[model samples]
Target: MAGYSRWIKPEVYPLLAPVGAVVGLMAMQLVRNVYTNPEVRVTKQNRAAGVLENFEEGERYSQHFVRRFVRGKRPEVMPNINKFFSDPE
Candidate 1:
């Protein structure tokens, strides 16, 4: 306790856990992005960009996990609320 107090103040103690948690989460996200994200993996491949390569790259990016997930969901409107207001009864 005495040794720790000399280096770090009591006031800063409460902040240490949260800060550490946030840093840990950030590091985990960085690792995930570097290892698992398609875009990052594609860039890391270090390939020369020819016409076919460019087309393939576009396809890869568009078909990334997030993109595919969002694309699978249907777009939503206000169920004709906008049209109802515009048309007037």
Candidate 2:
């Protein structure tokens, strides 16, 4: 639907590209992981803070993980800065 609208407004194509790429990658990941086919065991750690932090009493726990099958393979842990400070490598 969005693609079809591109013909009416060509400028919308570029804007749609980033969103399309993300959606496509997510869809591919879902299809790949549907059968529990993970080529590698990926371990990741994350820290969370701020207003949305999940806490109970005096204990503070924050971490999240999920299986994803995307076109890109994250073989290594790569840290990226916020978009405001992002730069080409």
Please list the C-alpha lDDT of all candidates, in the order they appear.
Answer: 0.70, 0.49
- Per-model TM-score, in order, reads 0.45, 0.31
Per-residue alpha-carbon lDDT of candidate 2 for residues 34-77, written as tens digits (9 for 90 to 100): 43333322333221232333345113111213423432664544
Decoy 1 TM-score against native = 0.45
Candidate 1 lDDT (Cα, whole model)?
0.70
Error of 1 at 20 (Å): 0.9
Which residue ranges in model 1 land beyond 4 Å of their true spot?
A: 1-3, 42-89
lDDT of 1 by residue, 18-68 (tens): 999999999987886676544554562443442343566567655777777
For model 1, what is the error of residue 74's alpha carbon versus the real structure, in angstroms, after optimal superposition? Answer: 16
Q: Please give me the total number of clashing residue pairs in predicted model 1.
A: 0
Q: Please report how far candidate 2 places residue 66 from its true position, in Å.
A: 14
